[model samples]
Target: MQTPRPKTRRTFIKNAALGLTAASVLPRTFAKESPQPDMSLSYQDLPQWRGFNFLDFFVPNPAHARVKTPEEHFKWMRDWGFDFVRIPMAYPYFLDIDYSKDITPEEVYKFSEEKIAHVDRIVEAANKYGLHVSLNLHRAPGYCINAGFQEPYNLWKDQDALDAFCHHWELWAKRYKGISPDLISFDLLNEPSLREDMNDQHGKREAVPAETYHRVAKAAVDRIRSIAPNHLIVADGNSGGHVAVPELADLKIGQSCRGYWPFNISHHKAPWVYKDPTGLPPPKWPDGPEANREALIKFYQPWFDLKESGVGVHCGECGCYKETPHDVFLSWFGDVLSVLAERGIGFGLWEMTGDFGFLNSGRSDVDYEDWYGYKLDRKLLNLLQSV
Candidate 1:
């Protein structure tokens, strides 16, 4: 039997907050403002922005259980020594369309202001807490790495999709026109891999053709910069944020990489990624290309090379699931994060407050601390802060 989506069970009301007052809707349990973000670091260079990915707008449907994040998540992230939050979003969430209907291209461009304020609630909250926010289109008008929904057009192969992609970026740019780049940046897309079938999540994937990625990303970047001249734009590496794209280096944009290098270690039994998750061996640290520190360094040499060429790079997503052994997870993660930190590259762990986060991760081995009914992995938190 299939598990049910939490849309019916989540009873917490989403607050429609405005301006700095967004913080007022925070959980009554935690009463403290996030420190103002240090403007000392420039966002264009992609400062060592280490933090978690917020999912409030990632899927953006009640059926998908996505809603606005409480300001407390931001405050605690700030108090915990993390400085960034990457929000992977679905554009349609802000649109005035029925989620159950087959969406037309025309309807795709239209969005609801009231719905968008929910998004503003997140950005404004992140800003209020002094955290740098990077907005990414996990589900663009025509493309996304993971599968669940179908698009009428293919972003990688169709001009119509490309147009929609650029149009959305233009909308976002206009929406936050005067926002400082230091506080928020726009990540053009999540992971740009070519798929034979858009709805098949477990099928063999191909890296997006470099030339095609170059064209699509350039178009979106140009469109965004035209509106918000100082906005920093970053693109995920081809092939699931692993392979660096020199094809886009010439563009004045940042490139993003990932921490899930070896699926064995990072996604040992992720049900979506593996057909029979239980058949796989329990994950071990320093296996295969990660057999040693030097081997791991060699794996990311391409990313470092990209940075050397003056293109800013950051690991946009990295983390193990609740199923991975805690000790092994940290042991492997420590090396992964250290490697990225050494070269001045920052990272955003896959998620926060869910399967792959430091809160409510549901790991059997962790000595979880109680944070207002939420479980906190103090060991993992300490490991991340050490770097």
Candidate 2:
């Protein structure tokens, strides 16, 4: 992945910009009552399961297939208070295929046993550590938000794509059939947004029409239950996990929400979201140029209502990039966590050990803790543990 290139930025200009930038912060209770992030949530309305995401298949290719997480991380997670781990996958990464050319639909169904054994190892090891594992397909059969390859069909509009989507889930349902639901769950897709095409990394993505989304989600859910009746399943919210999909509420599955509200802050200088974050005002806590806690409260009301309506809710992904000021990021994230916790919701940080993770975050201002060879962000870790 390309390193984020956030330009040297200033806070909203001092004099002229001061008056317009101030916004009320959430109550101090927001941070004091921190919520834990988890993916074992929103499924079967289980207790909030706390943990972090591991991005082995996030942007995999033939050369870097199956970058498994260190087993010690699972041991450490168990040592810590967290009880969950979400592993986002790229479907192609586990398949037997020739990467030199576009993959045929026939090849999509093919799996490589050696590559799949690594997944078995991960799930079994995490379970042994007593962490509930949520395996999600960040890159699916025919669509991906940060897509890298071209697919022959469109997931939202084509039967073939939906077939392959359900087939992959069916494969998992069989592999881990009869496992206790408390130990494992399958998040249907990373974030479902209707795109004009399958391969454009930067393309306009509107919500999949409610009917279309229901059809796709139900189809996948049906297939999973057919083989493994007790497999827990969670579907992401429509339009990049920001809005709840009423069409799916009847499906009796958990739904996910994102923590990147007031995008200017959570994704501060993220290149995939911002082509250039140069000269943009650095985000400020409580109220930045784009939003405040009031906005955040209003933004998640729909999700809260959905949870009230009996759909399990979880923040599948949340965290600031290394670019945001550490203090500012912490204050805002504290509110985000607290608010979700108040609603009995769970969350998952974007990752465990990368730019957005607990170790080697590359944040220049952090006071590092030398935990073995890892540059541990004890402040962030403490904040997460505070909830």
Candidate 3:
């Protein structure tokens, strides 16, 4: 249900310009016009459903798992106007086997049972809330995008690591066989890196090649489908949402599609990756909506047309860091919502609470209030509902 590309780039450019002006500057007609599209699909097809990440499984214990029950989380999301949640998990975290550095065969079997149970809990919770979920392997058995995790495992070279990775997916497929299609999908991996000794051959730290990623991604997809034929599989784009278009153009998979999240906004001011930290400011809420719309268009246009005939394209993650001003965050989100409404793309935020989340992950019950206070960002939520 993808909307046809805007009438022309010129129309988009003009509308985009108007969008940048203060919301009041724009003619009331634009806002009054019905936000609904001619076609209908779940929030997944509405473009505005782009949402937040629920990263309890990846971050280490205490911090990783959200204290709020899935029911509480989903209810908050619904009230906040989000349509989906992206959950990232590490293979080793749930498994009994210590896939941490070195592991034995017996440990692998033990880990398998644990991993299965954990995934089942997540899927069941997501379904309970009527929210779509994307399960991503944030840290594979041996590899991770971050160097800290990569050193000990040497995941790329270890054969055992790769086998454990494959085995985990096979188990996951079997465990969630009957999960509802609307409630969940599988993301093969988080950000897959292509660094040689922590740096790419180009000397630039980039994601692994599309071919290598696709190879493993396909394997996982095949295995998962064998067990749960209906689960939608999502493949991530290479480095920073830069899809190797040609590489993906030739790839064909049934009941599966690909997704991407360029780091421009969400990772802005992120200390872990960005050196300056302050260079990329969080999006401003007061910024005119059109300016935000153009940014969204600029970021997504390159990969927009990549949606295959039957497959869908989802912007799996996007959000400004919590450090960014709340107004800035709201402005950016408003613009994103407008464009997504027009384009009908699916999306999710980087996190729910914590560093980049909507809720304060540090507190037990939305305790620490930002300038925005305990109340959710109502303006942004209203705009999302409008879309």
Candidate 4:
């Protein structure tokens, strides 16, 4: 085994910009108050699952392979009143393979016992902490939104990729068969591509249609349902969770969206995004050059429509980078959380302690302390707690 290297800030940013790429509940009391349609999944549907993504040792790195999130951490989260955790995992890390060699059905489909046990520990911790866990494949078989990483086959077009993808999920479904859906949920893929890159011989940039994405997603959903019919399936919206796929409305699964709207504010100084916010007007709360209440709501219309149709909605990933001002973060977060709460949507902050995180994110401006075995970002932590 190789020494696992800690994931760097750049890598974290890439995942954040992407996984930051990708809710619920209520009813009954409204009968006397008014005829309010439950626009989101009930607390019972998701158990008010709300917290952060724990990526201390996600995937793709060999260094952190033996790492395990301390069970105490989950207990701390529960003590803090958080009941949800989204764990973004990478499939490649758990497979026994030589990247130098051509991937075969045997290699891609096989699981490493060590990695499998690591994930099992995570699930056990979540159950003990009473947290609802959303297991996500940050880097799936053929689709990884992070640029520069290439897959030999296109997940949407290649049969092998699709088969391997579904098989990987089937294994998970089989492994955690008895785990109740109320405790563990499956997040099919991290930010799926906006459009499938069509490398035509003419050197043109053609793209696949949106409906095609639905087909790809449904295939995975169908496979998982075949074995784990009761497991809750959560599918992320396309294009970094910026848009919703209406085709998935009838799929009977939860919908996920992001909170990095009006990127200038949420992703200020983010190296991954193309637009330069160097001279862009500073973002303000309720009214800014970028991201205001109306703008945020407008961007969420499609997702809102999905919720109105009685589908579950969750903001799987959402937050501003550490460079973002504290006040600005609070303002943006306040509005975002308010809207989510109003719509009865459940959300998980981008992360817990790095990059787009509340603690130990390397923000020089904020005061911090070693609390509960982690650097605590008091201001940000307070803001999140208030919500």
Write one digit per residue (lDDT tens) for candidate 3, span 107-177: 43344343345555655666566777777887766666654433334445555555556666766655454
Q: Clashing residue pairs in candidate 2, if any?
A: 34-387, 37-347, 38-347
Estimate TM-scores for all models: 0.87, 0.87, 0.70, 0.80
Ten residues in a row with the worst lDDT in model 1? Answer: 9-18
List the candidates ranked by TM-score, beginning with the highest.
1, 2, 4, 3
Which residue runs of candidate 4 sit more than 4 Å off their true CA positions?
1-47, 64-67, 99-106, 195-208, 274-283, 286-290
| Candidate 3, run of 10 with poorest lDDT | 24-33
Model 2, C-alpha of 102: deviation from truth (Å):
1.5
List runs of model 3 lying over 4 Å from the truth.
1-50, 60-70, 79-81, 97-109, 112-116, 150-159, 197-204, 242-246, 249-265, 275-296, 308-310, 361-375
Q: Candidate 4 at 143: error in angstroms?
A: 0.5
Give me the runs in candidate 2 sitting further than 4 Å from their true place. Answer: 1-44, 60-62, 288-290
| lDDT (tens digit, per residue) of candidate 1 on 182-274 | 777899998888888877987446798899999999999999878777768898999877899988977878889999866677886788888
Clashes of each: 1, 3, 21, 12
Q: How accurate is candidate 3 locally (lDDT)?
A: 0.54
For candidate 4, the 10 contiguous residues with the lowest summed lDDT are 22-31
Better of 1 and 4 by lDDT: 1
Error of 4 at 29 (Å): 41
- RMSD of candidates 1 onward, in order: 10.2, 16.2, 16.9, 12.0
Q: Which candidate tops TM-score?
A: 1
Instruction: Show pairs that collide, candidate 1.
Output: 37-130
lDDT per residue (tens digit) for residues 312-352 in model 4? 78889889887677788778887887777677776799887
Candidate 4 TM-score versus the reference:
0.80
